[model samples]
Target: MIKPGSRWKSRVCTAEAVLIRPPKSEGLPQCGGVDMAPVGEEAAPADMQPGLDQGCVVGKRYRSEATGIELLCTKAGQGSLGFAGAALDPVEAKKLPSSD
Candidate 1:
């Protein structure tokens, strides 16, 4: 269960994220096509699997409607974020109208 302030690190890439909106069910939040573990955990065999490799942009917001999850990119990396084989869509910031 990822909390609103929970942070996760990528397993294969130098990616990091913070959860804003979490899913109701326990859905694995993945980066580079692989599940991301908590920020701190016991040292385990590193996973060199490549996911989207398209890369993650810093300050970009990624969301998944199916699982009602949203995350903020803290650090940029050569990996794409997604879960369950579905790539998460980037949430574009809405533009403000100019006041003449």
Candidate 2:
């Protein structure tokens, strides 16, 4: 089970992430359409490749509503944040209105 402040790295790509929000329960965190391993863990052979073409970008945050899990991109790679079979969309920063 992943918890808040937990760090993980992409097994398939060069992407790395850290969990900001923990999931409600034990849920599998995936990136680039493959499961992610804990930081410092050996990379899985099955996840040693990019699953999606779009790929994840550096400095982007990804989250899931169903599980309430949030991840921040550390290193960029050809892997998009995903859970189960669905891809997680990048979190957009809200812009503040001008005080003019």
Candidate 3:
């Protein structure tokens, strides 16, 4: 099981992220449509799909609504973060209310 604080690296790109919240379902997160590998493990060489190279921004948080998975990007790369077959959306910053 992927628990909070676990680190992962994209197999097909330079993207790296930390798991802030684990998914409700059991599975690994995907990047560029490929499963991510644990930080210290050897990842097999794989090619990213053509349209999946939208790029993951550094220092951004992405979340999956379907599985309740959340990730914080630690390194930027050519692959976008995703869960299952859907792309992970960037977590929106909460707006501060104005003081009266």
Query: TM-score: which candidate is best?
Result: 3
Stretches of candidate 3 off by over 4 Å are: 94-100
- TM-score per candidate, chains pooled: 0.82, 0.80, 0.88
**Candidate 3 backbone collisions, by pair:** none
How many residue-pair clashes does candidate 3 contain?
0
Off by over 4 Å in 2: 47-51, 96-100
Better of 2 and 3 by lDDT: 3
The whole-model C-alpha lDDT of candidate 1 against the native structure comes to: 0.80
lDDT of 3 at 43: 90
Candidate 2 TM-score, C-alpha based: 0.80
Q: Rate the local accuracy (lDDT) of all candidates.
A: 0.80, 0.76, 0.89
Per-residue CA lDDT of model 2 for 30-80, tens digit only, reads 776778889887776455334454677778888888868788888887777
Error of 1 at 79 (Å): 1.2
Go through the candidates in order and give the C-alpha RMSD of each one to the true structure.
Answer: 2.9, 3.1, 2.8
Candidate 3 lDDT, 1-100, residue by residue in tens: 7899999999988999999999999889889989999999999967887677788898899998879999999999888888886679999877889879
lDDT of 1 by residue, 1-100 (tens): 6689898888878888888898767777788778888888743435544547777889999998888888888988777887766678999887989879
Clashing residue pairs for model 2: 12-47
What TM-score does candidate 3 get on C-alpha atoms? 0.88
Q: Highest lDDT, which number?
A: 3
